[model samples]
Target chain A: MPATRYRAAPAATLSIVSLDLMRAVYHRASGRTHLVSEPVPEILAALADEPLDEVALLDRLARDYAIEGDAAALGERLEELVATGLVEQL
Target chain B: MNHVFAVRIGPVGFRVGSDWRAPIDTLADLYRDYPAPEDGIPDFSVRLFARRPWRRVLRPQVMIGGDYTIPDAAPLPLSLGLLAAEMGMNLQMALAQRRYLLLHASCIERDGRAILMTGESGAGKSTLAALMMARGWRLMGDEFALVEPETGLIYSFPRLVSLKNQSVGVVGEALRGARFGPWQRDTPKGDIRHLVPDGASIAAMAEPARAAAILFPAYGHAPDRREVAPGECFVRLTQASTNYVALGERGFDTLTRLVRDVPATAIDYPDAATACAMVEEFAA
Candidate 1:
């Protein structure tokens, strides 16, 4: 699993916002909120610190989410997250 | 006979009258006219109290009876005043059974789905909601729509769409041949109530819509339509909801699910006509 980074801001300074059900926790420290609902922990672990392509990301998410059996389920969830602005292709 | 309904909302209760009742009945019809995509049982119920000969039931916290006259005090926020003066005994009664949620909004239906027009007073959401109704959209309610939680559905309770001072002309002239109540002058909120649509279509509360779309209508001199990302819409709509806070965890989950499935947008229009067109275009 890749190193998991947890960011927090002191007090109620952190503002939380959602787009299309994508939850983002904003850090008053940097004014940029991390996408908390993207299953960051799961995806990072599946990626294993390696720079793989989009297909690799999908594979990791699907495997972690157990989408091998459901097939379309993992892909659909990812598309929804993308629509919510939580995940973006580099 | 006290011509008032004592309505208890959460912890607050008020005496309301027929001016409020008539609209609620109208809303029921509107709901029936355009049944929700998934037809469901109506939540509105009527109860008879033998001891109180003239009383009518509106909601759990509210009962309709007697006569109510607009207070002589300065008009409050026209929308708030309308809510405070609701005649629909079943309005709040219906609220208690479902999730007790209330919003200052105007609702209209297109393609059998209800799209809520909500914002703070003076945001022109009412005018926009009313204009949409004039253009064939069914009226829900001018001031509020009670949303049922489990289904994320809306219950219609039609009432007069309020038009304060300058808005009277802006809306009245645009929807030409509109019917309006006499304008009361010098109220706290200033004279109001330009027109009450022929809200006859309001019969039953709509089977709650799945919130197919959310648009923050911005009326500007220059017309523009801003396609809002769902994330922004989710943030705004959740905040705008009547029971967003009260619904607690369940409410949060329900809202998240609804926004996920709906397309949210921010619309700008120069006038009522344009606004109506935008709603139709989007709903289609």
Candidate 2:
């Protein structure tokens, strides 16, 4: 069985503003503004570089950020991002 | 049309036509200080008309219609025609204007910098802005703050300030010689009246000012104030804005810049005096 991978929309498609507590993302593709916090923005930024499965993405996030959640939490955040069209399941 | 009035407020112009003379007469008096629309051409037209010919006189009800309308909006009595006209103009701007980003907030300016106050309907923002104006701050606008997307400057709308319930008396007492419209009692939003902005505010409507800060005010609480972070400001402003979704990227860019450049605060007060003092302290 293969692990599910995900990719984010290109950097050009999103206008991201970093506020201290959260990020305000304006998705150009859908012309909608979304406010995201924590690992959601981190996941999108990590995936913007390349497609990553659950394990690879988590590894990248842990190396760069002080991540508190485990694999299941990361999976839930990815699913929510995918539903919002910010992250695509590959 | 039996009567017509034209006036320009900040960057927008309105030409109002009506079937009866009373409402137009009221508008003409209220907006007497405002200049006619540029070259006598209005950007929007508001029509206060009767549903039927006989409705004009028998039991006069002013139905608001214009460039944009709610379609199912209930008519107001002839006595409340000024409100209908004001509502008609506001509807047109809310539904059709896209040149600038519109925030449902009250704004006051001092020393070329503007302060925006936004909250829910009964948040007392309007009353606070009016009170601030009485204390020498320039009233930029009451119902809407027009933010120019290109420059991120706040243009003064400075329309008549709609005072509801206790606020009518509060502002009336504060602005001793200021002109005001008729008081209509027991309407949808309780007692209602409108106050014309000072001559200085009307004269300087075209000049835009830099936004210095954002304030979210809540009335009927013990006076307290706190700093708001950029993230919270972004969320509150998006909800406050009327044309954010319509402007898309432009709106996002402008709002981000505003949130980043200005400080935001939330103030809760039990009375207008406390709110005004707190505002003065902050502005100082």
Candidate 3:
């Protein structure tokens, strides 16, 4: 499987922490240690050592997650995650 | 007139009172909708009295009140809404007592095993629970579930799945015979409240079953995608738990006891129907 791309979005700090609370425990038990949440295992794998911007994040995920066929679909997913405090706008 | 009512969230007793009567009715209605355990008489207790200056206190055991007067023994003075919020917090505390812990999430059960789903308010937790219930998963509890500490058994509470704002229609479409109460306006959480079909054994829902898996559900802008990871699921579950602070020495034991024995996953989907299908299929 290819890497998953994660987008960091603007949201309340509490929302971010709440997601972190879930992501942190999930990562800890899996032994996937990191300074923060949002770069899920799949996301981490895709962009290893290479930082990608917002569009790149979506483009990479569209290809890797098999979420193809519509560029609009990619934009929507990025925006949705941004709303959910999962991804950020650059 | 001050309206005071007592209801139990899992093992804790929460009494909420305010100058207004609607909150009491709202809470009482919430409890009445889901019958209590015939065996356990809600040993964990707390009393919230509403006065001009509402106060809340959490003693070693319970929060007692004497009308508007704050007794010297009262631990904290709280707002009326704070008393209401205690319902969730008390549930969290009670779950920490046993091997089971409360997650800041929602859960639905099928075949006696729980599929835990969690997310922030708008992340679609309630919507997912409602959809799964429509498709055949037993309504374990909405927004909160009580799991057995030692056995990872999820005790069913059969409570209403609270949907907020726009998600109400999303769930209604999925559930054919959904029932909803009148919408209350201008509350802290905004316009909300709806009731899914009452589970067949709601009155008998205290029966506990092992928690088979935990799924962190996320609704994507797209509608058909599904991702499943049993290993990562377990890891996320331990993180969603609310009692990690209270479980202490027993935290590791309790968490490992549950996660190591069961599976966990992260569920990302586009719509309620697809989400429900994925949950039911996985539980099956």
Task: Give the runs in model 3 whose Cα sits over 4 Å from its true position.
Answer: A1-90, B8-14, B17-19, B36-41, B44-99, B176-179, B186-189, B221-235
Q: Candidate 3 - CAPRI tier?
A: incorrect
Best-to-worst order by TM-score is 2, 3, 1
lDDT of 2 by residue, B1-284 (tens): 88999999998999999999999999999999899888889999999999889999799988999988886889899999889888999988888889888999999998898999999999998899999999999999999999998999999899999999989889988999989999876789998999999988898899999999899999889988999999999999999988899998999999998999989999999998999998887565
Evaluated on CA atoms against the true complex, candidate 3 attains a DockQ of 0.02
For candidate 3, write residues B1-284 as lDDT tens digits.
25665554444334444444544565565457554433545444334433334322221222334222224533322322333334433443445344456666777776677777776667787777777777776677775666665655676545456677777777777666666655644446765655644645364466666677666677775544344443344456556666655554345445555655665566678766677777776676
Number of the candidate with higher lDDT, 1 or 2: 2
Cα-based lDDT at residue A71, candidate 2 = 94
TM-score for all models, in order of appearance:
0.56, 0.97, 0.59
Q: Note the Cα lDDT for every prediction shown.
A: 0.52, 0.91, 0.53
Ranking by DockQ: 2, 1, 3
Q: After superposition, how far is residue A58 of candidate 1 from its true place, in Å?
A: 23
lDDT of 1: 0.52
The TM-score measured for candidate 2 stands at 0.97
